[model samples]
Target: MSVSDPLLKSLKRFVLEFRTTNIVVTDDNENLAKLCSVLEEIFQKGIKKSKFFDKSDFFWSWVAKLPSFSKERCNPILSMVIDTVKESKKVTLDLGRGRLFIRSALMKKVLTVPVQIIAKNRQLAREVYYENDSILGNEILAEILQSLLFELTEAHFQLRIHNASFLDRTWNLPIYKQYELVPCDNLGLHVQYINGFLLVKAVEPGSVGEENDKIHAGDVIDELHGEALRGNKMSAVHNILQRYKGLPVHIHVIKGYDSQGNLYKPIHHLIEDADIDIATADELLQVKKSTSNGYKKPPHTILNEEEAEEIPVHGSEGGASHEAHYLGYVSLGIDGRVVRIEDSVQGVLKNHTQRVPVRIELTEKEVLVIDIKDNKTLLQHAYTEISACGRRTDQLQHIAYIAGETSCSLAKKFNCYVFEMKTNEEARFALCAIAQGFERTHLLL
Candidate 1:
């Protein structure tokens, strides 16, 4: 309960040893082993901890990479954890499968207990070091704490998305299975070009595309307005849309399906060709022939002799830059990371209850459409109300609150739209129209 508690003490010791002394304990490190044991006990013996592993990437990553871990570990551990949690009565673990979360007053306290102790010591050490240069402690303790907190934040984000898996499963699946119309509003739909195909990523909920079921995530756009979109970059799609601003555009899409006509779900397949040890005689022959024909090895390929050890190859879900204005009001990082939809604007209906795609990048510039799932309830509130889009021309200091906070809040009532200006002065007009249009429609109080 207190920082002086035995569990907290052990946690602090582990952190200090992990950061300061590096005598190379690795998998055999007693401190780390003890820490893992403690975590295992908490997960197994503590009934309230059952929801910690549900769809958690951090938990899954640890389970996948740790020794003596298996799916079987879950059932018994979860059962015990539940009982322990119920008996203690100190913390209440609400098993919310719909949101895929374990909510308890003690959960945060438990996770942060170790970090808090280390952080306090770290701050003291920092002050001591400033006064006396010989003072001890790792300089990177703050970074470590920050990293741990970030992981917690990311894990929470993942859980929310997993709980809201219905949108993609029920509504969006139809569009990918059969042909559907994707609405392209005044801003545009979010998309990414991958492997010579353009796929729709997100759509605003109340927008024409979403309301009419014109577009859906995972539908591959093969052509736009009779022109083949294959092999073209996202810029090309932008260009074609800009060229014909208001015309009824015809888009041909390759619905997600297999050659067998079975519905295709997104999957991660192992790279059989990447396995060197399991090559057959025919495969060896092909490799020899290919080598003889002047095939050069890839640049990053290291000779086996120069490598210290073989690093296991894992397949990635893939990554790409994503943006969508057509779906419930959402925006992404220019680099394509999913930015929070609710934070984008007011009245845009920010539902932290749903799951939007967090980044699942494979290579630096590729994204597999299947990797992104469960995004319907996200930003569902702001579909039809957006009246105008605009860019903030003010200083950066004045922009965050005005653009992100003020404008979005205003949009909820007036249905005004504001967007980052990209060589277009139209959004400014839209902002003005929002005020004028509202005043014209109703007498001011």
Candidate 2:
């Protein structure tokens, strides 16, 4: 469908609702008759997915706020709409065939953002939302669409973490100028159709590469590790960045350059960490410990509930209530706004399948010890399934045994993991590890 189809329908519906007799035959008599005919056809046709089917009634509550609209006169149309959508078993089956709905989550698309039209053409509309929140609704469609759009627009705002806070990039000199982004968790050093952002977590280590030189926990991250600070896709630079933890990246005061330059800016000089007393103290301890997940060599390892208990607390504070705050963030790069995990539930739509999170981020910046959180991270991690099969990431053959199905294609479609209750502990860990951080590749065990 052409993109204009959506706007066209809105146009037709808006005209019809004006009920101006001079424009057409908008008479109380004609309206009542047309309304009846329209209603009859709708019930008979079962609400065809029309280009002109203005779901006005769905958002009519907000429309009602308009002064010209009359609740009394609009009753007939509203009544007819309600009766039409109030479905019977056969009607629902015919309407929503092949819909993969999650239990308790299937919601009517009823939320509407109240936006005042600006400018003459009404082309500029801004959503009205509370100062503290974004104009997002609780639906997968909104999640995907809004997130995609947000990222696309956000990519334009080049971020600069100009924290000359740390004065130590003694190693090989800070490459603030040689800027590029390697793929991160869901983002590869080089990837296409990136759904997440160029998540840059850096710290300015006091020391250098050596543990002594290596920036400590309190160091401030200078560059997004030398990224141009984009929420869009750019492959001119390298695609993968690894061993990022415990490394203090240099800060380059990179200014946007001519498109002709290939975005290569020489590293800027180091910024002094003048008075980082407060910031330094705050940086030492994360608000909460991250959901720590790593196992000894022997892949597919498992340290289930019983084994996990003995793990001691890392620091002194052990009984804290608030652990950490983590939120799922996706970036569409240039596309802006979060796109739907196009195939979040790709379990062979016809067959059942499973997938695991190669990496789970329970905390963005927190250090909760096992004793303090009582393994809450593990609980949340356990519930974290490979919710969606990404663009082309596939599964492992062993997953076939877990799913007990001959074909793996089913699970491959949704980018999900398949695990069994009867599996051993090691198998569980493998799935968990992939869910935590599938480095260089996605493990499909």
Which structure among the candidates has the greatest lDDT? 1
Which regions of candidate 1 are displaced past 4 Å? Answer: 1-188, 258-261, 264-445
lDDT of 2 by residue, 357-437 (tens): 222222222212122233343223211222321121122212211111112222322222223223343333333333233
C-alpha RMSD by candidate, in order: 23.9, 25.3
In candidate 2, where is summed lDDT lowest over 10 consecutive residues?
A: 97-106
Reference-based lDDT, residue 255, model 2: 20
- Candidate 1 residue-wise lDDT at 256: 36
lDDT of 2 at 102: 8
List the candidates' TM-scores in order: 0.21, 0.16
lDDT accuracy of residue 103 in candidate 1: 22
TM-score of 2: 0.16
How close to the true structure is residue 185 of candidate 1, measured as C-alpha lDDT? 30
